[model samples]
Target: MTEIFVKSLPLKDVISNLAEAFDTVYFNRCQEYQINIPEKYGTGFIRGINFDNGFGLLEYSCSFKESLSIHFSVNNIHPLKFIYCSEGTVKHRFEETNKLQTIDQFQNVIVASTSKNGHILLFPRNQKIQLNSLEISRKDFKKKIDCDLNHVNVNLRKLFRDLNARSLFFYHGNYSIGMSNCIDSLKVNGLDGFTRRLFLEGKSNEILSIQIEDFEDDQKEEPKRRILRKADMIQIQKAASLLKQELHAPLTIKDLAKKVGTNPTKLQEGFRFTFGLTVNNYLNKIRLDYARDQLMLGELNISEISGNIGISNKSYFSRLFKAAYNINPKDFSKKIKRNSSQQH
Candidate 1:
């Protein structure tokens, strides 16, 4: 909510002392949120109870010439942190009490707590370093993706590192300005509150998608080969049609599969193969498309649209509709109305 900027402050003695002083004051106000950065060692720490309001604030201390250790701790309850490193290589120690590990220069690190403690250490290359922390919650996270987390972690790190490396190389080779300019853009163009929350949610899903793509690329598992037979496809189609007709009703995959004279697994496989999307995906697409059509008629608001579509959660319904249509439901409806007026 509040942005504080400090420029060219003394890093070694003064800045560290200031950080220590601030930590003492911050901890006293709210026992739930605690921060400690010792004056002797070039390190910092932050802890928060809930990520609802967002992560606790911190004062970054770094010398333009010295390499500083920026220590961060997120309790197990807090969601993953998407960190964008602006300058220098950051070695990250994933969970609490783990060996010191490093995420090389120009990379984004996703830190999640497996148990109750998660931590990260940033080793700055230059005194002038910039970074943005986007806090994400597990509840708002969606992983419709079908890959194991352990399998995806390594691949994700590699993919991000590769992307950052390529981007940096291109910028340095072709652009007039250097890496500093790029870092400035990244830090300054940081998202506003709503967008930052959305970005965090999107990034989590993006990570999962990357893992799914990795699996698809490796050819270790093939969906086409495991697709259902013609008979099973027919059953799935029938079930899908029935579900489509009853779009205003609450339908479960299990019940739908049973109604089609098949089990859930076979139905899911067949539906996915036949439609090129998961059963839930197909169902949502149908619902949203129907909602769009109704909105074009200019007869209902979002709440009514959600209710008529058998989705009780209006916010979730809006999110789903936006995800499907590439525009928010309200905006899509407004555009439709504007187009109608133009036609008239």
Candidate 2:
């Protein structure tokens, strides 16, 4: 396996430093950046969006073939960040305590506080990692809001206040179901230039807004959150992937749990804790999304689409599709055809 050597860069202005790390990094007319690292080690792109204000975003959808290890330190108050792992995993360990936190797929947080000390990020080989690092300078972030900080969500306000001190604070939770869908909608595979920048920045702010709402909801949770063993967490995630693979099959939750090597109770609670949706709700979401795409493609009628996705009741399928997308399946397909003809 070939290992890529990385030079140390500044952490305070993380986005700009990211711009410098790549051999093919450039800023577009919009001041957004496109970063392409050496291909021998990994393949894919990193997109960065910088606003006139200090708000910024760095989105990574790259996979490495060899392990990556880096040591870095930030002396200044680090940018307040909202980190989400939409795919793969990322681990962070501070040097002083060596305590670590791992963010798994579909998990998110408005970063835990960090000491001014150094930390290391490890990226294992063969894992396709997709991450969104949204951040703002502590000073700029504080200025962006006009209202009294104290009146904001206690958890959010507390996170900001932690920036002023030498201590670190950490909160790990899942984003709202709406936010998770938004995350899935971020398409970066073949995008370029202004369109890519527009989507990244717009969606970044939208996710940030929902993150604030998440923080408020975080305060309402009971003091105790169910803790799962690392092995159990892995099994739960395996179950989720299985669900996606067998999305059209009419497998009950019991079968799902058994296949993933966990009990029904753990499966339900784990789904709720990790993905912010129950098993049935999550399954329906993916199925409906698939049906909607099939409808847009004009490949199948409502009945075929519904049956293909394992919904035996045609009325119920239409109701579910309409409730989720606000458009009847038939009309959605009609609109797709009409637009295609108009373009022609």
Candidate 3:
């Protein structure tokens, strides 16, 4: 098993004086990648920014060793990128692109790029990139902008190209500041996944509605809008119900969506809007709540409780339980038992 180290810092508090912080968190539990933190200066400086709902924005910069290669796997569906650069430079080569391009210092702008090839090369001499990884689903994004996915992609690409074509635009010759400000607003005003789904869906529909009004003014055909009807709401409710019922099963978004007769994307949006939780978060809450109930019953050991909750790996279960409850499962059970005995 390989382990990857993760370090996160809050930037809103530390960005004034250009201060830097560094540390390494152990990752022996992850079986995927063995991440090595070289004894390099100023490699893991991160500042955290809170977004709307439970989402978080992280800004960080790293300087890699000459010819040093780091390898890791990524969940392909989620969108990821390094959108802004304060200083220094780095070249990224993806399996999809043969050429390596240097992303230089661009103040107050967001750069949107994808990493399908899973390889990024950081130049040695103090390379810095202010990255904002928006953990938004493709479906939700479409709803927010009230455009089809393909059209949205085309428009976004055009936006990026327009920004790049100009040496200087608005304040910083880059559109990153505008995008970042917009994201900040979304993070501050948007609801949690559950609430955001409804908000985004409504917003998207509203955009299409406005577009329709414009078309009417121009005497053109109205554009078709992808609105979530009553059936869609019912399907989302059904999926949430099923997920709640099968708390101990390996519930996947795909499986839940299929069972409810909807696609994964819509299922995700609907679940978030209807339940105020992502599918995985909702399921985990179910499992954790069940585990708590079992602990209170005093009939099951920690291992048994974990197993019954469908967390087959005892150690992983313990860690997860601790992360959620702020105590190890065994200790939590003991505390419950002690309290029960005292009450009697």
Q: Can you give the TM-score per candidate against the true fold?
A: 0.34, 0.58, 0.36
Residues forming the 10-long window of minimal summed lDDT in candidate 3: 26-35
Please write out the lDDT profile of model 2 over residues 1-344, one tens digit for every residue.
33223222222234345545544455454665556655866877666667634577767788876876544456655656678887899776554666767878777756544555544556778799988877666655566664677668866676766646466656777655567767777763356667866777788788888777666755653322233323357778888888778766857998887787667766888888788899999899989988988888887888888888888898899899999999888788899999999999
After superposition on all CA atoms, how large is the RMSD of candidate 1? 19.4
Cα-lDDT of candidate 3: 0.47
Overall lDDT per candidate, in order of appearance: 0.50, 0.69, 0.47
Candidate 3 Cα outliers beyond 4 Å, as residue runs = 1-230
Give per-model CA RMSD. Answer: 19.4, 11.4, 22.0
Query: What tens-digit string does per-residue lDDT give for candidate 3 at 1-344?
Result: 12222221122322321222224332221111112233654355433343332233443445544333222224332222323344555444443456565555532222233422233434444444444332223333333434443443343434323422221111111222223334334335636544654554344334333322322222322123122332367677777678767766766787776777767766666667677788788778878888888888888887887777678899998888889999988899889989989999
Q: How close is candidate 3 to the true structure, as a TM-score?
A: 0.36
Which one is best on lDDT? Answer: 2
Model 1 shows how many backbone clashes? 3
Worst lDDT window (10 residues) for model 2? 3-12
Considering TM-score, where higher is better, how would the candidates rank from best to worst?
2, 3, 1
Of the candidates numbered 2 and 3, which has the greater TM-score value? 2
The whole-model C-alpha lDDT of candidate 2 against the native structure comes to: 0.69
